[model samples]
Target: MNLALAAAALAGTPNDSHGESISQGVDSKHILVSQAQDWVAEDRQLQKSTIEVAPSDRRLIIPVCNTAFEFNYPFASSQKTLRAVCPSSGWQIFLGISVHQSDNALRYTGNFKAGHQLTGTDVELASLSSAIAGLAGDLRAIEGFSLASAVRAGDLVMQRQLVTPIEGYRLNRAVAAGEIVESSSIDSILIASATLSAGQTVTLEQLDGARAARDLAAGKVLSSYDIKKRHQVLITQSGIPRGHPVTRANIALQDYYGKLPNDSLQNYRSAEQMQAIRNLAAGTMLRLSDLTPIDIIRKGDNVQLSVRAGALEITVTMLALENARLEQRVLLLNPESGEEIQAIATAVGQARGLSTVAR
Candidate 1:
């Protein structure tokens, strides 16, 4: 590549007839001039900006953190996006044409606007300096992840993109120039689960995975409320009467029935069959295909209940005895015989009914 070629290409100034080149002096002065011109061209970075991205893109607005100074009182937020532009270099000084002619790199950087507040936050600041510094760092972080790709959609390009999981992940291990490695490890990740976080710790979440692992009951139909696994069921360690606070999902009544099959209640019709199950407890796992809802019914007995869309004979002990005095369970019995036919246990509702007398 001739050092003078670029000059000749741009300026078709007839080569001095005597072959005396226009670059009679490719000195520091000439290089400096070019450098100045380069700066001039890049002067209005915002104006001269060619969005190196898709023309029509919608950038994802991720809420990095919430700023609240007082407890229970959330800070009022008028969120404004901070934008970052890439200038790549600042004040540059091109010294002596090509260094092949004279080895010298005279590039200097002054002030560059990497980013700006598209919409700015008006935080009640105790200290302006701290806020400003924090904001600068945040701006840089935003800039660091602002990758512009020329994604073409038809004739126009859309420069918008979502912030992917590992978008700004920084790789650690160095591979020699020509190494063909299948994978690379990261030095660390930027963010982790809202519940977990550490500098270099990473959360390897499988997309659409269970928010957290738990027993998946066969008929458990999940809903939006269950989608967020914020409520952690903690069982008591005391090993007394199998009355530990069992971790049963608080499924919606509607969802519970919706999941049950049409013929679920039919399986538990007999008095003897229902009689065998007076010791039902809340948090008890029920599978109507194998479990009965209302156990034990005698002759002339009337089962009291309404069947809804999701009909299931779910046999369950009351969590606490029904209609109690001194928090104790009362017996639902045969008034004539004064014998306990049905028992409503207290606290952790479980069945404690007497055996049916033979006619």
Candidate 2:
């Protein structure tokens, strides 16, 4: 019998006869060749294709498996060989087979360095052998991909060697270390196809209030590590006494570029109603921990208590029961009525009753 018919017969193909006996185990070589043929037919979608298996030891035997055999192509570039494994017996063998080649593949038109962005003119589709056809990815979809490694002219273009482009920000001009990065400093949004060795690139939103952490060249893609948040900290222009309120006269906004202190105050408005917790020297960066809310009224101080009802307002003297900051609720004692009441501190020596007293 011919090699193809013998392989099929050994792999349990039914003969014209009803029943046959005298089974003496299956030949290992025949099983390998049969499985290789099945792999090409099923995986490669080739119908009745001819497959030539290399000859092995004629004495080699493989036990008949109750379950189906498994075949796998181990090489990525070529399907010239396959591994046949018997699941039940754990018997495995490698078999060499012939596979026809006539597939289209993309090849580089000229030598290109790593990071070179691919264009339509850079590659062309050409007929390649099936042994290496798997390395040639979808040729029509490879445009705009960047090369991860250098490739020579006429070399097969591979999917594994390409990187997809991403959108990121690029610098318009060279920025020195410690310089603040503004919106004008960004040239444009870059569609980066090149592999980034320095890490992920930055976005336009990240440039809102950022400063360069190091010297960067023009056209360089900005990474998160390359920039820091630019801070506008409130710094004391003159010595401030403890308990003194932080005002524009004693403090000024200073541009600070670097890592910011966790407690550093950024807005002057926030500091206007705060008092120094301790004596602060000139040029000290104001921090949240170094300041406390200023007291608008002190304990035992006489304050004007205003009560209003239906457009009628009456002011009376009331004694503060506790020191309180603006908008803080404070306990007050009405000297005339000798009654304790809650009022909101409005200003120095001034308190407003919580509810309108109907005259």
Candidate 3:
């Protein structure tokens, strides 16, 4: 007789009528089913109510084992099939099972059109079975993604239906041609259009020292080709005559987007104590070679010559023999003694004697 049927008959037969005890033999089928249920609950971390075990056939019979039965999953590489083995008896049986887990997934709260960017209000978490939830991608990251196609209310948000937004910078206000592209004047934005790619966008660091190449409208997305590095070059605001001082009043620093000459002057301090070497028109870019150090002493000028010895000093008026700047050596002629002296030009009309010689 089948073990299942015999177990059922024994369960139905009264002990007094059969004059036999209920524990005469073990029910192998019941043991296998109980063991499979316990395995699913413990190993799979599934609730007993969520696990379903198929009923054993009443005609199927499994021999009772003298030792403990070992259990394993033998088919589909999953916990669906539970194989219970009677090691001592060399018999085993396969049982089928199903596990259902409840999970949360993101779904559209209302109908949305294509190209619509998902916001917090557009999606909500909804309870769903594992089989249905698996179809949806990560629920937490669906927000801020643009929809590739229209979606209806209560539809689950899926990875395939999303178009990642292209991140870039946009001008907060209109920028005129040749104006500096300041980081504070632009705002970061996301473009939801399918036609744009990430490579077409520009980053904030790329905008450093950048200027607009042309007139740009407000809220327009900026690209790498739309901006150029701003180069600073000194420009004359008014015509500077030759021998005139190159001061801040006449020359101003201007921003240039195009390439500048290698000799262009970049700082105002560099032009200190310098004079224009040639006539420069208004708005002309200043170059290093265009200016010369201002001469503190001019030829044929009378300069005070000072001679110093141990605890003694002598001052005399002499004629400068050559044009010289401060700290430059110049020859001076002594009118009374007809003597020549080499001295360093100290001021506009002053010189310090270095050595004396007879003419």
Candidate 4:
């Protein structure tokens, strides 16, 4: 391929045709320019630009190759030597162009508080500056974030200045002082079981179960007082003997002053079976601490033991050595072998275990 011919082919001016004789069907210059534009547009780093591409003023003519045209460099950009080549032709030409960004990156529309979550309307594109020179012109880079410090209007919002918004609970409407904070008025929640105290965070479930202990302003963060702590206790209608099951009929709601356990009296309202640990007089508050779970198997009682090993299960009558609750492990004496084996109490008077040698 002749250098003169390559110059002639690339020449934009028609009067200075040096190698016009070279085969010219498709405009290789135009194709190279188009390919160069595409290269810049597809570039991951250079895509954010307004590229102005123009053919060089010099003339060059080269043999048109059968293969596709390509750039000698991996990328094309402004003020860079864009070497377009026809691989099969073994020739290439250089062009000079410019890539410019039309505007600055992120600019604030108005003063923003430090904790305010950034939104699309809060910022807009403006002239590019060194402050935001490295930042991309993307809303996603800043949206949903808050400012690390207060930003004045028209200030450049830098990526380093932005921070992820911290998640917290807030009220949707004004809550009266001492009014119960309901689920409907809360924007977010945290789960907890304690009574609301002043400045102590409370969850919606805890609030829904309690009344406002004091006057609480609307939107004010809830404290311990926002939640009423009184809980209903199972009271005794009559003397409940030790080991006797406590039913709802014998209990009533009463204000409790102490901290309740995770398994609070609220659980017994569903009518779950619980028994007294010791004898209690009539009207005694049936605290959970004073109650023991019902015994499914009693001491010295004859119970059927389901001795199991993998898939095989065998039944043997055994005498329980001690009282056991549901799923409680109990010692049983296998009468036939005269051996005491440990078995889990499953049902009333029914125990199951794996067979073991007498000990």
Candidate 5:
């Protein structure tokens, strides 16, 4: 994945009382391949020869990740204008909902270097106020929000009131080291296709340091003229059938000050029920997730699931798919039958009229 296309690799543990449970997950994370019959289209920067299976040929469809959505985050016209921008668009969100110690800290890094340097500390309040308000508004809506930056310190901090009346969310995590930990522009988002080299390695590009700054130095934070980033990732495996992971990765980028960009950012997901009807009617391509599995009744008879929205709209549909893995022994009856047929499964969806769904 090019930096422009995808990003995120989770890490960090929320320092709190429940920290024990927060630090580790029941299972360590590892990349797995899936979809043996299908071909693999190596996504981003991952090379695969494996497949990842959703425990039950299904996984709980939790709302996660966002991409094009960030592209829509309405650009804020410098902070001075004081326009009450609510961060309604453009800015994308990487919901590090994982309370796991290794997944709590949100990381943000892009191309921007210390925002357009100002002539004086007094600059304009309107723009800064707008930025603060915009920043604060976003904090209020998202839970446990933290502001990371390369320049915030002392007086440059974002107070709770600036974010929301809600008491819980705030920039509480202090930087233990450098400048990159706090600033939005200092964080880095990467995308690529790579083979397995290390087993879940945590690469700390910058040492830890002071958290977000509320103050500033004379020089601007450095940045390349053209930089790209992202928070959502799609890992596709290589080899036989290959597999794809619809997941959110955990990652963070800290600058010289240990500061990361803004963490008050948010990501969104449309519920299954909501997308199904449209897909069924206009032939919309509903998320594969929305399809719930029904019981298998008979041979040739399809397994059924519902495409629904809320409790009101539900469309029952057929889902027939074949899945088989090579068992130890071969088929006995067919004497002449060759080695064992590892996997076999038929897939039948309500594809009859689903073609029109593609955008």
Candidate 6:
């Protein structure tokens, strides 16, 4: 049988975790060939070979050696002679080796534009014997990732060729301190900021200290610019009434551009489900200390009331007589009885009160 082919067939045979043969090395020649296969680089594989092992040599026990046994190459680059060395026993055997080029590679099935995200459909397996430098061997690693560079049909997809999508806010133009960054001058850039040739991501903290180091031109990619620390202020989109829940609808984010007092919402999520402590006019810049969380019950607002008595729990609708936050005492008016009672604000528009008959 062909030596390299014999080695491949025997090498693939299932073995235990420690690589002990399930067949107990019953086929000694095959086991010896399989041992030589391990020396080949992952990128290369043995093809065909002529191995000569003496009948007397086959019976000799070789102790495991920590160093690798050298395989001698005697012929052209495609063919070799592998010699297994037993350093402890001082024994050596020469085996004629023949090898063919092998490659685990990826080939593009179709053309893709630069900056395009690579999909599974764009790639397919290449021939195993066709080795290409820098080619990717695993499809799972590259699929769904974007290519760092473009590729043509039949082009090789290599490691480090794909990138993860970047998502964040990018500045469209530069600004001086205390100047409000206009909407037209900034946008969300999904590409990585490090590779960005034109934009810089603006964080809420950056808004506090951020400013153009000097005059910056429009269409300038932000990644290269330096920004001082700053707080991105939330601007009132519309006039916000006192006690009104602050939402995205009524507020917009803005970066400080000039020398101004530091005041703004640091987190975009903070605006969600929050209420204004006082009335804010349209376009008013917001500060972290300016707004409070929404009150659970508000004055003149309709609220659901839960009354607990022993095992009986009753739910009734009532009007709030005063504004209150969670767990705060608030006065609730019974619309039908025209009487007010004390209740604890529990949740938004929800309150808990003691059961009482109308007085």
Candidate number with the higher lDDT (1 or 6): 6
**Model 4 ranges off by over 4 Å:** 1-35, 42-103, 126-136, 160-174, 182-210, 219-242, 247-260, 263-274, 278-290, 297-346, 350-359
Cα distance off (Å), candidate 1, residue 296: 9.5
Model 1: residue 151 alpha-carbon error in angstroms: 4.8
Tens-digit lDDT track for model 2 on 1-359?
12221211234322323222214234444555676687778887665355556545444444555566798876888676666777776766666666544666788999998767788889887875554734655666787677888999999888787787677777889999878887888866425356664455666766777888999999987878889866689999999999888898999999776678898998877787789989999999999999999998999999999988879998989998899999999988887777787899999899889852322
Minimum summed lDDT over a 10-residue window in model 2 is located at 1-10
Residue 339 local lDDT, model 5 = 21
Which model is ahead, 5 or 6, in terms of TM-score? 6
Better by TM-score, candidate 5 or 2: 2
Ranking by TM-score: 4, 2, 3, 6, 1, 5
lDDT of 6: 0.63
Mind giving the per-residue lDDT tens digits that candidate 6 earns over 26-83?
Answer: 4445555666665544225334332332323343333334445555444445444556
lDDT of 5 at 119: 22
For all predictions, the C-alpha RMSD in Å is: 25.0, 11.6, 12.5, 8.4, 38.0, 15.8
Worst 10 residues of 3 by lDDT: 1-10
Q: Which lDDT value does model 5 have at 99?
A: 11
Give stretches of model 6 more than 4 Å off.
1-28, 38-81, 85-90, 109-113, 119-122, 128-134, 140-145, 149-154, 158-167, 170-195, 198-204, 207-359
Model 5, span 1-359: residue lDDT tens: 01121112223323445534323321211111122101122321223322122222222111222211121112354211111111333222221111111111111222212221112231111223123322222222334322222332223323331211111111223332223343433333221112112332122222122233333332322221111222222111221111211122211122222222342212223221111111222212223443222221223334333333556644333323332111211111111332222112222222111211111
Ranking by lDDT: 3, 2, 4, 6, 1, 5
TM-scores of the candidates are 0.18, 0.54, 0.43, 0.55, 0.15, 0.33
> For model 4, how does the per-residue alpha-carbon lDDT over 1-359 read when each residue is reduced to its tens digit?
00111122433333434455333523655566667777756753555346555554434443455777676542434335456666765655665546655555777899976666678999887765344355646777876677767888988777767766533455677666445556777666332222232356554546664655656556655555455754665556788888788876776666554356654465455435578778889977666777777888989899999877778988889999899988989999978778998889999889888546567
Candidate 2's TM-score = 0.54
What is the Å distance of residue 165 in model 5 from its true position? 34
Q: What is the C-alpha local distance difference test score of each model? A: 0.25, 0.75, 0.75, 0.64, 0.23, 0.63
How many clashes in each structure?
Answer: 25, 1, 0, 32, 98, 26
